[model samples]
Target chain A: MNSPLFFLSYFVLSALVLVTAMAAVSFRNLVHCGLSLAFAFLALGAFYILLGAEFLGFVQILVYVGAVAVLIMFVILLAKPGVEERRWGWRDLVGRFAGVGVSLAVFLALLISVFRSPSLAVKAPEAPVFSIAVLGEKLVTEYVLPLQATGLLLTVAVLAAVIFASQEVTKK
Target chain B: MLEDKSIYPDLREGRRVVRPGGKREAKPLNFPARRPWLTLGLAGAAGVFGALVGVAVLLFLMEWLKPGFLGEGCFLYAALADLDRAPAILLNGFLAYIASFVPVPPILLGILSALIVIGVLIGVFLSLFALTSVVERKVLARIQNRYGPNRVGPCGLLQPVADGVKMLVKEDIVPAGADRVVHFFAPVVMLVPALLVLAILPYGPGLVPMELSVGILFFFAMGATTEVAVFMAGWGSTNKYSLLGAMRAIAQMISYELPLIVSAVAVVMLAGSLSPEKIVETQAGYWAGIVPAWFVFTPWGFAGFLLFFIAAQAESNRSPFDLPEGESELVAGHLTEYSGFKYATFFIAEYVGLFAISGLAVTLFLGGWYAPSPLLAFIPGYIWFFVKLYSLVLLAIWIRGTVPRVRIDQLMEFAWKFLIPMSFVVVVAAAVWHYSGGGFLGWVVCTPLLLVPYLLFGSAFAKKFAPSGRVYRYSQG
Candidate 1:
């Protein structure tokens, strides 16, 4: 059984996640949206710690809140000022409605799947050590192919970034 | 004096005004003879007295009043491990007394203990951070053949206190157009990462605040938030200068942090652990019972240390790489809009960051808390750690004094075109050395592997940046 402190922290972090997520979507300023999104990510990271994934939690904070969010803010700051709000047309209104409809449908589907899962009734087993050493060993041995695939993906992403940055579009 | 417009009225207008004023007055003809030595002596005596009182309290608690309140063998066990258990033990005893009257959950006790430990650490290190600023200023002033802050209590020993008071009492300004919430949060965000990184540093044996299995990764992970904080400050300020400064500062930090992390990878690879204490422990033995097995001595490690040091300078925004706050150029960068205690908070963050990174360097490349030689083992490891750490800090100050700030373009070039490539070579060299067991043949193979690239890159860099000899024309000597 978990301690009440654990539940209290979980509730606090979940509250942070919900609030920041809402703020991220609803904030008017693009920079504020990005920052709120970063806060959401940070809260999620804290949630990971509550789930007994300390490394994953810190990595989330390091990568998403630190790098990705900073990069988003960089682009936001670099974009031309006074590009805030735009007038909405009929197409835009329709698009907004469609987006909301799609998201609601997806949420309902996810809810059904979670409730329907047989595994949901089972209690969690005691967590493994899951230390960095164990993680590294597993990655190299059992999950080596996935690790290589991730590396490949990262390389391809870097190549794409280089191509986009250089901007020498071949007129083929 | 508090007129905001008067301070920088023309800055926004892109104009400079020269006020005609009387020439500097000669030294006062009727100046009284001042006895600075008396004040200095008194300050020294007071410091010694304070230290003695602290020691006496520690002794009284540990020996004379070994509180029966403390569990049996608690003191001996904590002392044997060399952990800083004073705060925790004291808190436990206090809490136990409370728990005798009222029930306390184990979780609550644990949480309260952690809180007390963190509180004590923050109090102690914040004082150290303040002292570092005063130390840096004094050292820089001495290097420039000037007395610094002598008016503030005996050789400026009390200067940080005065500075803190000034920062607190000064007006806190916010530009009308600034994002008030984000601006308020920026300094707080900035301070958090600096403090967080301090948690991972192993001050001495068993003295780590939090010994995460991935301590070094934790340090860098916390470090990543600094750029985001910088960006927030810049964007929130609504000033072009602040935005530009923030961008430059963030870019510099991102750039330099690459080599900094990569260089430490060599140490991590060799130590086979990410924990700072483990890394230090691996470097404990002696080569010939004289030379301590510090990573700095290995060829690859030597290169990595140099790379880490240089990149750290940029990351910390110390001079030569201090283009972010280039006073003559960017008007204090992201800090342009900050004033008073807000600015002082940023100042504290920078110094704290400097100390943290340098302390990391010590843990990685230097012998950490280990004495340099076995013969000098009488001095404690924590003392040795601080000695090496402050020496690096002084070296940073010296470099700041000696070198001119590099241009932004040059700074970027140095990180990407030079340091990053060199770091890769150093990593390769470490691998080679490791595989070869770092014997004589390994040196033969790895030295050129490391140096050839260095020579080529150094020549290319020198050719581009080094000034050609100047010839004077129309000189009538």
Candidate 2:
């Protein structure tokens, strides 16, 4: 698992993720940005697969790359026909600096939590042979409440979206 | 002028058409008359002979190689286990033989085997794509009472070849306003996912290309990329029709994908695994040592199969569900701006996508490679797999021929109002069937559970949406 090929692929995938994520944010064309975001999501899924969470990787791709990215593209296409170009003003520069500072702060907080975690202090254990069935069992048995909550939240969101869309249609 | 007119039938009829000179007409320099059947027969015979010879050579090579030299994964030994495993074994044996002498690393050997599997899958499915393209036209032609592409070699069997040649030679046109990179990559993106999905399907007992724990999820994940690719094609083309077509396709796909995945979830629940191989294994054996215990044999399974089939049809953008590429409105949809081999690639991707979906249906409901009866178990599993697959493809073609393209709104309504609810019913029915000990009691309970909703939905939809009567406005009734 820790073979040179593994390291090579990991590095390559990470590079792809970073490149695509950067492109997603920087691209002027909204569609291009959406596509880049999809690629980023896909690369992230690949990272999940690399970490041996095959089910999670697939779900990540299916939900994010497949559904979320597509929804983003749909919204972009439906909203406007032209590229979204914003002038770089003093306010924009200040906002960028503020955004950088916030992101850096968040990153540092995450880094500190990771370094301080008790699990990380211990020697790494043997990689467990994880199966989807076990994960599903845990979801239903131990994490059933969370699962139900998520489902309920999603259902409500869907209903709200339907209502909103239907109202607009009626208005039109 | 009169003498020339007498030599030509049209001229003699006073049409005054110019005729080629007798010297030019008399020149029969080369080529025999088109003997399509004879050519086809010869090709078939040659192919069989070549395959036999190739098998014989492989057998001879296996015989000559030392048995233990290639180690445990050697095909020479595996081939002896079951004759059905012979093809895969022989191929692996050949690879193993190379590895034995070459001192290849284990990872490289694994990669090599994976590559071979990928290659074989691509080759087989691409050929299937070609065959389906011609067969689809022929089936549609039969439905329409028209001869389809009979002028091509051997009753249009070689039409795909001609089409390929034509596509290859044709100009690769790109719209001046199109985004060059995105436009160029769209077909490739479309093709990659179509091919990738094929990897997870269990073609036979030990014949899956890439067996992952989450095979079904992987398949759906790969399939999701098609939407992105379609969007790329539409957006990159900078054509409104293309964009609209892409949007329609994406919407239709997303709507139908819910039912598709949910219906499959029923099977996964019953089978107790996301892996297609596991699902197929759970579906093995006969009910009374006669009927194959395919999922479609059960009531919920049957309903799930239907829902999956319909959703699969919509997913592949086939006729009836093909509102995105509705010819009356959108000129080729997202494909309008594509030309030549790029267009050909898109066409191949569509058929391959169809094959993948059909293949998945076979895996889930029809029993992946299991024979219909124990009596038919003599046939190889992959053969049975392909048989089921091609049958589903034929059914798809039949439906495409019979049904008209559905309206986009109607398509959405069907997916959302009917298919989704029915699929949920199927999942519940599947759970009931499982919990109730899965036999006569299961059937009695599940059938009505599925049927009642279906009937209610059908009636409600029909009452609300079905046109009452067509009144003649300007024409006499």
Q: Per-residue alpha-carbon lDDT of model 2 for B413-445, expressed as tens digits?
A: 999899999999999999999999998999889
- The candidate maximizing DockQ is 2
Count of clashing pairs, candidate 2: 0
User: Relative to the true structure, how large is the alpha-carbon lDDT of every model?
Assistant: 0.81, 0.86
Interface RMSD for candidates 1 onward, in order: 1.2, 0.5
Quote the positional error of residue B91 for candidate 2 in Å: 2.9
Could you say which candidate leads in lDDT?
A: 2
lDDT of 1: 0.81
- Candidate 2: give its CA RMSD in angstroms: 6.3
Q: Residue B147 in candidate 1 has what lDDT?
A: 49
Model 2 docking category: high
Where does candidate 1 chain B have its weakest 10-residue lDDT segment? B1-10
TM-scores of the candidates, chain A only: 0.87, 0.86
Clashing residue pairs for model 2: none
Candidate 2 residue-wise lDDT, A1-172, digit = tens: 4589988999999999999999999888888999999999999999999887878898999999999999999989778855866778899899999999999999999999998887777743577787777888899999999999999999999999889878977897
Q: Taking the true A–B contacts (Cα pairs closer than 8 Å), what share appears in each candidate?
A: 0.67, 0.82
TM-score of chain A of 2: 0.86
